[model samples]
Target: MTALDTEVAQSVGDIRESYLAQVGRRRLYSGLALLIFVVLMVSGFNIADERNAGGFWEGLHQIGDYPGEVLTEAWQKRADLPGLISEFFPALVETVNIAAVSTIIGAVGGLILSLLGTRGLAKWPRLIPLFRRVSDILRAVPEIVIALVLIFILGGGPVPAMIAIALHTAGALAKMFSEVAENADLKPVQGLASTGATWTQRMMLGVLPQVAPNYVSYTLLRFEINIRASAILGFVGAGGLGYELRNAMAWGPGRFDEAAAIFILLFSTIVFFDQVSSRYRNRLTEGQAQ
Candidate 1:
């Protein structure tokens, strides 16, 4: 080969080797990162298990024991099951109401926060960062913490749980809503402004129409989650099926049937909502696509 051709061939071979070396280094780094992540996860799990009231292996066999006992007692007193469900129906209603009210309140609050925080949609663009920080603080605080604190102050009832869940929902939904708002078309907003529309008018007529479906989908999903949270808060004296369940457990062996009834009610309610929410969410997304 000519000298220039030979030189070009050598240069290409060097470049190919360098590229392979870089790929090998990246693979090595990725492997190391994955290994470290696995190690941390395993160690964290071990530490948590050590601190738990029951050991994992010891508890594994007994996991089915309580359910089996509950089932046996429930089956023997099957005739009374419907009556028990009827008795506790009001508590179930209270739980659902708490979830529904909280979801509505939170959705409204979140909508305001989202509009305030989102770029190009904010009423006051300069205060966008402040609104975002407020949302962050709200989201960071757990629902249980707020519920427990409110329980101490307001006395244990559905109100405390409802407020707690609403606060959390507002923060959580704020972030999601802001993300949706950020992508909203600004042309309608500009057109409305040209007609001397106020901020509320622009948002209600221009922005909300575009994002309403997704917002409703998110709110429905939140309602499902809030139902569970309200029930759990009830265990801590908020007054719902969980309160009844706690009472039944406190009564020991004789009240296993009552506990079983509560279990069935809670499980059925959760499953029903899950199915309904999933169906509605699917329809909303499909509608949005069309």
Candidate 2:
């Protein structure tokens, strides 16, 4: 073959080698990542098992025992289930109320945070990082931890749960809302600004209208989450259906019926709100599509 042909063949060989090397590197990186993930999972499980009182495997096998006992007793006393449910209805209401109030307050806080943290809509653009960091910090702490801290200071009640959920919700929603805000058209905001609108006025009149549906949609979703959070907080003395359920469970055996009643109430309420929120979210999405 000619020298030209040999050079061309060498170039082709070089390209093939380069391609193989790239592929090999990618595979190596991927394999390393997977191995690291598996190691972390195994080690984490071992640590947790070591820390557990009953041993993870042993406890896992018995997980259903308590639930089965509770259900059997509850079924035996099914005749009185209606009365028990009625007795705990007010506690159920309180739990729902806690969720609702928290969602509203959190939505408002998230709205402000979103607008302030977003690039295009921030009133104080220089402080965007500060706002974003604040959002992160708020979201990092779990609602239960916040509730416990507040409970220590304020005593156990719905207020602690509400405030705890609201703070976490604000941070969670802010992150979501900022993403939506980032895509919003800037023309309306500019128009408002030209007319000497204040920062709040500009956001309220220009940005809010565009993002309101998504904001409401997120708020509704957060409300559902907060309901569960509120109940769990009640277990720590936040005073709701969860508190009643905890007391019933603590009584053991004889009180399983009451625990079952509270469980049913909490489950039914969650399902009902889930359906309602889903329906409304669909409506909002359809309206936006139109």
Top candidate on lDDT is 2
Clashing residue pairs in candidate 1 (N, C-alpha, C atoms within 3 angstroms): none
Question: Model 2 misses residue 150 by how many Å?
Answer: 2.6
Model 1, range 209-230, lDDT digits (tens) per residue?
9999999999999999989988
Stretches of candidate 2 off by over 4 Å are none
Whole-model Cα lDDT per candidate? Answer: 0.93, 0.94
Candidates' RMSD to native:
1.5, 1.9
- Candidate 2: Cα lDDT at 83: 100
On a 0 to 1 TM-score scale, where does candidate 2 land against the true structure?
0.92
lDDT of 2 by residue, 1-290 (tens): 69999999999999999999999999999999999999999999999889888897778889899999999999999999999999999999999999999999998899899899999888789999999999999999999999999999999889999999999999999999999999999999999999999998999999999989998999999998989999999998999999999999899999999999999999999999999999999999899999
Residue 234, candidate 1: how far off, in angstroms?
Answer: 1.1
Per-candidate clashes, comma-separated: 0, 0
